[model samples]
Target: MTAGDPGGLDFWSFVELANRRLAEEYGFKHQLATELLLTLNRASNIVTYDLEASVHRPHGLSWSGFRLLFVTWLAGPLEAKKAAELTGMSRAAVSNLAKTLVADGSLNRESGVRDGRSVLLSLTDAGHRDMIEVFREHNEREDEWAGVLSPEEQRILVMLLDKLVTSRDQFDVRGRN
Candidate 1:
């Protein structure tokens, strides 16, 4: 909101100004952590929005829908509970989305063989075919994003991210297996 602030300002400018304000007003000592999380979240949102808008939406899928389909396509004929875990979605969400997907002929929901109360979800033949095509486009966009970084930088970034994920246990934070 200062002289050089372009209206809402840009992400980096906001981060810079925020850190300065927090330091001046509160003597905040967590600026590094704040910046790291803000950058990571912004990057994630940007990439997710791009992929959903460009690749998934054109193929008639929302981000959540694509995630459900992708999981079923890969490890399908599995229980809805398992799919929920793999996709990081709630059981009820997966169940609801499954109804829509099934209605669209992209997914099939059936009673579990062992437990009649449990639901099993799988990609239909057409769904499988569509996923193959969509994933190709998805990977191309992923490659374009990765292309911005040198291979070594990419590798290091992945390693660091993996380390952070793996470290969740240290804080008693549970995550998908």
Candidate 2:
């Protein structure tokens, strides 16, 4: 029943033993499962923080910048408000990011045909190239992170995550408490 024995005492079982030690030896109040969940949340946050830091660019772009690039890359030659609707971002955000991307020459923006005041945005050749590189790097990073899983497992994981994200009842903007 030691850790050296494969089936005798596995990783999860070792966690159980440690849980017992904490509760029995030190008179810890919380249940083992609660403690485990808290530990899992902390680990998840730390990993996300590290991953974000690693992926951060010093080019003065925020998460909104990346998101704007993605939406425009997908649906460019698109109206500014239309891009905002598609991306689920605010009109102001799209307006500002579109201006920045236009300034950087990554995107092309012109006055709308129907409305002189309205703007339409499209990806320039450089924008497409940058998007291709970004997507390639993103795919490589995803593969590296999920390399332990088979392709089928990865598909299933994506399916499950998508379901969770798209389910309306799961989202709550305000805290219940």
lDDT per residue as tens, model 1, 1-177: 343645877889989988998898779999999999999999999999999999999999999999999988888589998989888988888989999999999999889879988988888999999999999999999999999999999999999999988778878785543
**Residue pairs in collision within model 2:** none
TM per candidate comes to 0.91, 0.58
Q: lDDT by residue for model 2 over 69-143, one digit each (tens)?
A: 777788658888888877778888788888888898888888999998888888889878887776676557656
RMSD of 2: 7.9
Q: What ranges in model 1 sit over 4 Å off?
A: 1-8, 174-177
Candidate 2 overall lDDT versus native: 0.71
Q: What is the TM-score of candidate 1?
A: 0.91
TM-score winner: 1
What clash pairs does model 1 have?
Answer: none
Give Cα distance to truth, residue 8, candidate 2, Å: 27
The per-residue C-alpha lDDT of model 1 at residue 35 equals 98
